[model samples]
Target: LGNVRGKDWRIQTNVYGNGSTTRGREERYLVPFDPTEEPHRYSILWTPDYIIFYIDDVPIREVVRSDAMGGDFPSKPMSVYATIWDGSSWATSYGRIKINYKYAPYVSEFSDLVLRGCRVGPIQQVDSADRCAEAVEELMSADYALLTPRKRAAMRRFRERYTIYSFCYDQHRYGNVTFPDCDYVSSEHSRFGEWGDNKFPPKEVRRARRRSRKPSAVDDQPSK
Candidate 1:
């Protein structure tokens, strides 16, 4: 097979035997039994740019030409040929498909051979549009307001781990100051409410105040 993008090509064949002029591009060979033994059929289909050989309806060889590698590959007419020959050296090494020594000057039979023209279409492209659309839809439906503290912590962890520079903080919609960089605002030494320019206390401070009122460690814990 030849790549439609003109990237690769291959050749295959089976024509073995002694005294065979099998040189250059001759890859394989096979011998058949003498005439009078069950006669076998072999055929070749040639197009404007390719040649395909078949044995009893089973494809055995394919030859694609260099000129047929591009978009306008050969889609024209062609012919076929079959003849018996002494292919001893190549055939013996490759093993014989059929032996025809009994009928000296072995007459290889060729009947019911046919040639037909065919048209093949181009390959289809992968469709990623639907998958992309679905992903965008999911992102749009995500509830930034209802995001739990645990989720926020996870996002923070991810951003820190990946060294991300840009992220969305929905504090403005929740009556809290939105800091462009949370890393610069959160400090281990300062009390939660006293950090940066935040007036309503940081998220940690609100959680601490709520915990002081309820006196529950579970309440202080980030919700999943």
Candidate 2:
């Protein structure tokens, strides 16, 4: 199957053959035989250099032109698979088509597939993983300003690659009630309010005090 963007593609073999061959010219074969009638296995092996298509331990096709793919080759490791597809094309040259509606719904069975020389490894280093987990825990437990530089860098890298797993801080949820987004309160202000005494005046309060001291009410009093 090919992605709609004409990239990230795969090919499958089944009855009604609906499979593609890239030798000389690209040819697609249709198979209509129901493999489910008698069990069979299908597998695909993908490596850094090539993709091998197999049928019951027999190698049928080998896709070896990774360089021709420019940068679209499947470089990352992948697992093997076996899947069935309903025949929706011309029947194979072999007599495998279901002629009547009684057998209209054909089923293909895939089993006993093997992945040769497959290996699994952690996506990131153990230290990086711990750092990422710790960063998240700290963000959840403390204020954003308390986040250390190392933690912040780790968080940034985690977010850039795996955005869904990144941590977020809800400044509005610091206390029991949600604060208005328009409020200009900084993290330091919030921290002081929560931990320190609520004696330090805010910028707005200071400005109000200065304005109150001005002679505004009697500025227009005529030479009393």
Candidate 3:
């Protein structure tokens, strides 16, 4: 359910509980750019039927609900939260690393906030059925909600180039059961190892790994 970050920082998205019939999935990718150098936009679009995750207007991943999915899709309403804490003890590096207080008081910033959805009170009688339908229609009609051919192609390219782990192709872990919602692509599947790690990392990622590794004493001896 969690992972340790390698020397190269990568971004990951997860929806838990699907494996044990509780509805969960995960995807990971090496970030295209240095996030610390500048601020970038990240957004999530969730509807009754599908969910999309975006980075600066580019749709990176989409999940569509299906009958086979059952309760795995997130159906309930939830609030948005921006957390700035490290989960090193458990989630990151499996407790090998701890948060260093030298970098205390981290800051997270947000801007241009926009939330669009039908608001329903705890009591269902507070909102009319007709009003809720109207809201749903409007949200579905928005440009961002519609992933056209171009957007789909872009998404495919991003996944091919950056995706390092995806539960959909992790046959080793799932034991031959592909998640119902996954849109299987043979070409993309070929890039991943049986265990879900990238089989052939891009040149840049390889270079980064080489740089991060320490030189062993044996390698320091000159060849005769």
Ten contiguous residues with the weakest lDDT in model 3 = 213-222
List model 1 lDDT by residue over 15-98, tens digit each: 222223321223321221211324445555544334455433334434454532332233332224656565543233223333
Q: Tell me the alpha-carbon RMSD of every candidate.
A: 32.2, 30.0, 9.8
Model 1, stretches more than 4 Å misplaced?
1-23, 29-37, 67-83, 89-105, 115-224
Report the CA-based lDDT of candidate 3 relative to the real structure: 0.69
Q: TM-scores across all candidates? A: 0.28, 0.30, 0.76
Give lDDT per model, in order: 0.33, 0.32, 0.69
Instruction: For model 2, state the Cα shift of residue 222 in Å.
Output: 99
Q: After superposition, how far is residue 185 of candidate 3 from its true place, in Å?
A: 1.8
lDDT of 2 by residue, 1-224 (tens): 21112111122332111122221111121111223234445555544444444433334334443344434444443434445453334222112432344544645444454444434455632234453455435433433223344433433332222111100122222334322211233542442333222223222322332333211221212332
Summarize candidate 3's per-residue lDDT along 1-224 as a digit string, tens digits: 22233345567787643235443487887654545445667888888789899877777899998998777887665567777667777433336767666766766678888888888665553456587787888989999999887777767666776687888877777878978888888887788878777788655643533444211111222334
Better of 1 and 2 by TM-score: 2
| Each model's backbone clash number | 19, 11, 6
Best by TM-score: 3
